[model samples]
Target: MKYPNGTKMIKSNYKDNFTSKQSFGNRGMTLEEDINATNNYYVETDRAIIHKKPTPVQIVNVNYPKRSAAVITEGYFKQASTTDYNGIYRNKYIDFEAKVTKNKTLFPLANIHEHQIKHMESITRHGGISFIVIRFALYNETYFLQGEKLFSYWNDKLKGGRKSIPYQAIKEEGFFIPFHYQARVNYLSIIDKLYF
Candidate 1:
């Protein structure tokens, strides 16, 4: 099976050693899957209505099969997306992009596009909540970094500063998201503390 982040989950022979309560394998679950599960939990409990935006696909051609449904012969992404998730929370608009990096020292700013940065800036300008959920897969840690803070790093790069946000800087500026069994990322709780 593949996780939402497109990582394949390998079947291990050591499954018998793990308890039912255990979550993930030695590599852990992808950030995308955890966030999706968290959003589902939020929606189920009426806490917030959030969902991962589906990527727009342009169908180029289709083939009709004799015994099965039509198959897509060619397709392409319509465009690069602005963010991963967006929704209403406590009467406020929430928008954010989720990103994961395996680097241990820094998060390369190029992972985020210029248009996405502009979109985030627009959201914050209009008084909506915007941010990025960056996961350091190597460390198995995720952090919630506000849009404004992200812009600072982005702008710095444009001004010939560092082209990445160092891990130390993120640890100091971003809030660590706690992992839970049900909520997974549990980022909304940090949002409650930070914004509400």
Candidate 2:
């Protein structure tokens, strides 16, 4: 019997092409893009319905050069945005904010507004799922931190504690999310583990 020659059968360029394609997959994708893609996948697969909440803006002036091209020259925020996204997953209300930071050591507390904290607090109080998705851009790592856990840090900061959560702390407390083909962020998997 003739033995199969694996080395001779494999294409030389296959490894190069595969690695290049894998590297290209996450090239220049912002946190928003990843979440949006994940949300779209969730919706498409009948897993969940989630979307990025639009910022509330009031247009003060508009310039129209053509019927199809109208530009808002001036606008003001109607109110402070509560969070980045909210939706229902597995019959539970899901509310979260997504933040991307270039900081290497810590995530600045200032990145999260007081009002947003209150909003997340309210969601938790009402038995809803609330959390924040923090992405450390330098390391290209995404973490899922529960709102309940975040509240302790916020309270500490208010009481003369560190102004930022150390990267080490997050690595300990937060769930590290792995990227996937369909669910780019795949945060729902974390939710499933935590809630379900």
Candidate 3:
């Protein structure tokens, strides 16, 4: 896989010409990539302690080259990630998922996986700040939807006829995350305004 900038992202495939989509298709980078960049900036500036959740992988086949490091030939990921990012800020536990879509009207509730919902619920139960950073890719707007609000909307949609949450509904329920150069998402500022 290669980033939009043509840099190799993931491990190479055997086929020389095979190049899977590196980032989620929308603008140039995925929501994950954007969040990661923001998090890296935060860490470098000592503004926050958030980090992307690392997936555990087991390497089976490894080839050691002459006078060099070993290369992993085969591996298996253990499980799915519960959340995109989580860490401490001001001694408070924070957890959140980052997502994006090209849809202009609404963000489909189905985009959020059930396990991720459960994980967010768990974070809330433990008194942690849990939310999701959602991007309306076409409009270039991002919102931080709190976990409870997300669950309510998800349940309501599931029990009735609605298949997606309208942008206006999200605008009312979710906090608009301000864009910034340092902390790109700047979600904590929203949290301070809404939940703190």
Best by TM-score: 1
- Cα deviation of 141, candidate 1, in Å: 0.5
Q: Per-residue lDDT for 78-174 in model 3, tens only?
A: 6555886899876779999887766778889888888888889989999999998888866667899989988887788778957787888888888
Single out the weakest 10-residue window by summed lDDT for candidate 1.
Answer: 13-22
Error of 3 at 18 (Å): 21
Native-referenced Cα lDDT, model 1: 0.85
State the displacement of the C-alpha of residue 61, model 2, in Å, after optimal TM-score superposition: 2.0
Cα lDDT tens digits, model 2, 129-183, are 9999998877788899999889999999999998999999999999998899879
Candidate 1 vs candidate 3: which has greater TM-score?
1
Reference-based lDDT, each prediction: 0.85, 0.85, 0.76
Q: Any runs in candidate 2 off by more than 4 Å, and if so which?
A: 1-23, 63-71, 77-79
Per-residue accuracy of model 1 over 1-196 as CA lDDT, tens digit each: 1235434335432232233223363234567878988999999999999999987789999999999999988987776657879999999999999997878999999899999999999999999999999988767888999999999999999999999999998999999998888899899998999998
lDDT of 2: 0.85
- Residue 29 in model 3: shift from native, Å? 4.5
